[model samples]
Every structure is written in C-alpha cells, then in structure tokens.
Target: RRSKDIRFAFDRVFNEDATQEQVFAGTTKHLITSVLNGYNTTVFAYGATGCGKTHTISGTPDDPGIIFLTMRELFERIQATEEEMSTDLSISYLEVYNESICDLLLEDGGRGRSLALREDQNGVVVAGLSEHHPKTVREVMQLLLLGNKNRAMSPTCANAVSSRSHAVLQVNVRRRPRTASISSNVTVATMSIIDLAGSERASVTKNTGGRLLEG
Candidate 1:
C-alpha cells in the first residue's frame, strides 16, 4: 500500500464544546462594527448534510444564535449613539431553492410572483423584494421567525428535516449625523447573514426527483 499526506489551513477552528457565544464572538462579532461604519458584510455557513449549519446560524430560543446576538449588539450600539447618529434599520429575508428565488418575508408564504436579481450601485440585489423597518431587536427576531417558518425543508436519509434552500437575511443600515445639514452625506451599508443548504449525495441522502435536483 502507498500513503500520501494532504494538509489544509484555516483562520480558526472550533470544536463541539465551543459555545455559540464563543463562536459568534470569534468569527462574526467584528462584522457588526463594519456594518455600522458603512461597509457591507456577510456571514454564511456551508457543509455537508447534518453538519450543524442551521444550528449554528439559528439556534434554539433558550440558547439563541448568531442572528439574535448580532441584532442585539447592533441595537445596543444604535441606542448608545442615538444622540450623535440617527440610524435606520431595515430587514429583508429570502430563500434560493432549485435555482429560484423567493421572498420569505411575503405574507403569502413566498408563493407569489418570482423575484429577480439585479445589480445596482451597491451591488447585486433582489428586485421588487419587500423590506421592513424594525425598531427593536425583538421585532427583528419576530421577522426572522416568520421567515424561517416559510423556508423550504424536506426529509432525506442523511437528515430528517433538511433545509432545501439557502436562507438569506439582509439588514440594511443607514446613518447620518443627528445635527448634520440636509446636504450631509448619509452612510449606508448592508449585512447579509445566510444559512446555506447542506450538500448531499444521492447514495447517502436517498433523494429522488426534485429533492435530488436540489441537492
């Protein structure tokens, strides 16, 4: 027999004992500051089926997750600087399934018209997608709950409740000096938190037809 060695490097690695807070602080906490400084940021998880992608992105109520933690810190910072900076926060959630985009924030469970992607000055964006202004972290979490309820899910041999799509939560932040003149420039940025669908192999997941195609 012949043996070969392969090595890979990463910025950081976490073990099963690592708490959600530790993971968030080490990996994603810095992005919140960037968003406030008018820089776009995104955090996403990708891996094979049943690898804890969803659990890391959206944890249980008792033990919250990255989304909740990020929102809490964002709101706290906004409140602390309310007198110096007037800020606005808006959020939109959507999913990509089977190469199709659906607005998860839609009242009709994202089954209405199809959404298209277009590029603007900022970057690529979903055209005609709905956006909601949330005043507090609780409100933003409510919106998240609603969107998750509408996300696509299916059963597979690898995992019982497998996510069938990529779920993206977009938070738009706009800020201006509270005492600035009307002509003063306003800083705007977007933070995207995405939970990607897990990869699957037909032999392992036992998927067929549509599910297989999604994988």
Candidate 2:
C-alpha cells in the first residue's frame, strides 16, 4: 500500500517490465533530483521469513540486488549530476535481536534497554531503536554480513542457519537546494532494507544451541 503523503517512485513511472535499463536510469535521476530539492524518501522491504528478504537486500555485489542497484544508481546519478548540483548521502545499518537494537558493524555494542514498542503523537509506531551512521556502501554491506553472522540461528529438520532477528538497513540522503527560487529547506530521503525474523515457533523449529541460547 502507498502512503497518502508520498506520491513519487520509479517503479510506478518507469514500469520495470517495460524497460529495466531506462527504468533504473530514470529512478536514479529522480533520486538525485529529490536529494538536491530536500525531499526524503525510503525504500523499505517487509515480509515473512524465507521470502527472499536477504536475497533482496544483500545479494552478491556483482550480481547486484536492490540495495546494490540503488547504491550504484545513486552514486552514478550523483556523478552524472555533478555538473549541475551537489548532494550528500549517509547510511546506517542495525539489527533488532530479541527486541534489542545493536550495531551490525560494531563489536556487539548496543543500548541499555531492548527495543520498546511505542507510538508517535500521530499514533504511528515510532518504535524503540538507536541508529549508527555508515559512510560507504561497503561499510553498510560489511555490517549487514556481520549482523547475518551474528544472527541467532538453529538447525531443524527443515533448514539450517535460519535468521533469528530483524535487521533494518537505512539510507539517509541529505540535499540542500542551491537557489532560493525553489524550496531551500534541507530534505532527507531514506531507504530501508528490512530483514525480518522467521515466523516459525519454538515447537516447529525444535531449536537448540544458538537458537536455544537465544531462547
């Protein structure tokens, strides 16, 4: 479902099936423009376990999954727009483990309390969490792998190394309009790559070891 306030996207305009290259090119172009104009955006992924969340977010860099594609598109587009405008992009990646938030790249560093569920003034979830800043896509990707390595997992009759935590990879794009003729407010856009924990139960998983340790 689309948010009532957000009315811009590449897939909606380009129609991915129509032309992948042009679509990719166009989306990157919009992202660059949005960043310069002070508009924040987020590309988030959500779904049940084993639904290709990891495959989508952290796929091989060469093969290029969504995150990689977006990063490449962003930098490439920014480079392309260097003649006209300038922009800045920052990234942060973290994992929610047993309701606790931790830095994916740091050595097991986290907060005092676990993630708490809360609502903002608008009654929307502001959720409990702390975030870290990542400078490069390589840093973000490395932290993702680190988090995956640390992710709670277990063996069942079905599969091995099942993800036991929810991971959130966030990208914050900051853009300042060059001229006052247009809206000059600094705008930020976000892209969130979320990998959720598995839905299987303890009984179903018959978990032990790291899983039991998580238990």
Compare the candidates by lDDT and give the number of the best one. Answer: 1
Q: Count the backbone clashes (under 3 Å) in each candidate.
A: 0, 6
Judge candidate 2 against the unseen true structure and give its global Cα lDDT, from 0 to 1.
0.58
Compute the lDDT of residue 139 as modeled in candidate 1: 93
List model 2 lDDT by residue over 121-193, tens digit each: 4343325344455555676567667766655555564356566777776666665545534655655566665
lDDT of 1 by residue, 169-188 (tens): 99999999989998999999
Candidate 1 colliding pairs? none
Q: Which stretches of candidate 1 lie over 4 Å from their true place?
A: 1-5
Worst 10 residues of 1 by lDDT: 105-114
lDDT (C-alpha, whole model) for all candidates = 0.90, 0.58
All-Cα superposition RMSD per candidate: 1.5, 7.8
